[model samples]
Target: MTGGPKASRRVICAALAGAAALSATLFPGAAALAGPADKLRDSLSRGRSAEISAPPIARFVAQDGRVFVLDRTQPAPMLKFEDSPEVWVLSPSPAPRGDVIYKNDLGEPMLRATRLGGVTLFSRQRPAGEPVSLAGGGVPLRLGGLSPQALSERMLQASVRSGRAARRQVVFEAEATPASAALIADAAMVVSLAFVRLAGRDRDALGQVDSVRFSEGRRPSASLADGVLTIVVSPGHGLAGRPSSDRVAKAIRTAD
Candidate 1:
């Protein structure tokens, strides 16, 4: 007589799958982007969480057929595109109609989810948003472990790229260790993203960044002082140990 949350989730998934199929037919070539969607759907049919209150970690298929995964199990929720190695930390905010909107560090909308389990993704590829349907629960996103040597190399490469873009020395001073390797490596990218965000706001802002310093601390944070950007990472905080790239950028902006 009554199906409960799991049954409701299945029905929603079915409806979305139907929509996706119809879209493919109406808009020729839409099927090209359905590979990931098909895979996700198959996984969902296997099993996943059915409650909207605590949405499951899952892959979602956009109306345009683009695929991405959203993992909420992390200390800070993370998003990863199917074609990218980068994992984005997103901040959740309330939206209309009992939906939730996830935004990046720059306060830009990345994804919006309805209470019923539908998602809308916003990106440069699709500024407005593309309707996204539940695919199925997905694996958690984990930062790859790097040896001390590899960590040093990654920091070097990241600093070089940041420096080249800034037209000045973007030296990085990091304390390396096996436990902190992944966080440190990701810190380099966070600083780089911060620089990019700064440059986006003001083309010459990158000129103000001289160096970046990383250290372990009680909490994650970023600060800019006298042209130096310092990032504090708390190893105990796990994935949330380092200040987000958006926070790094904000620190620079506020300092300027």
Candidate 2:
């Protein structure tokens, strides 16, 4: 009868509708899942880069804010920074919680408070060798400038005040929230890295070593080239018996 054909048609239509509903339920669009800020936060949280734009201005922000970086510290064969900045954004990494300003390509920072209010304050990018106003950004933040040595002292004092000491930390003098911060002593971003010979090349020799740690009392930096390891620390920090340590010898041999 005609009714049999109509009944089958209705069943097929219902099934298709049900399938569409289920699909919508299972795979929601990205906007439905997360807002722009939330997406940026998540992207940075995983040590990725995020480009944020607030009309007339857009810059890269590294979710990972580390001032002191050792290049190729741990090479993963080849490292790709799809999300991180190309030239180390040098901005504050978001804290475990709370809001903060984001920095830009020219090192000038901008503020965006998304929740309680939705307002963005922008600033002119600093020209090279020109003084940058730490307070120019409309955000009400107390920014401090210090040499790396002075910042190290402040960190020591902070640890004393809190009665919690961190043996080694890469911190900045900027007014970071209760959580994180840094500033380059001279340049906005200072990259101190060395070449290591690995597998007959400097890289091959250097890659054999797991990590390079500075145990000296004065925080020093290190570089490796042509099988020689150079340690540079503040004057008067004893270096006797440091390079002679068996660990150092092993690291050297591993590199060699």
- For model 1, residues 80-137, the per-residue Cα lDDT tens digits are 8787546787888877655778888667899887755666789887998888877777
What lDDT does the true structure give each of the candidates? 0.77, 0.32
lDDT of 1: 0.77
For residues 1-256, write the lDDT of model 2, one tens digit per residue: 8799999999999999998788778877844666777866776576543222232222222233211111111111011123322222223334222444444423344443333323243432222212111111121112244555564565444323212111222222233222122322111112111221122233334333332322222443444455334433222322211222222333444543
For each candidate, give its TM-score against the true structure: 0.68, 0.18
Off by over 4 Å in 2: 1-51, 54-89, 95-256
lDDT score of residue 147 within candidate 1: 88
Q: 173 in model 1: Cα distance from truth in Å?
A: 0.6
Candidate 2: residue 170 lDDT (0-100) = 21
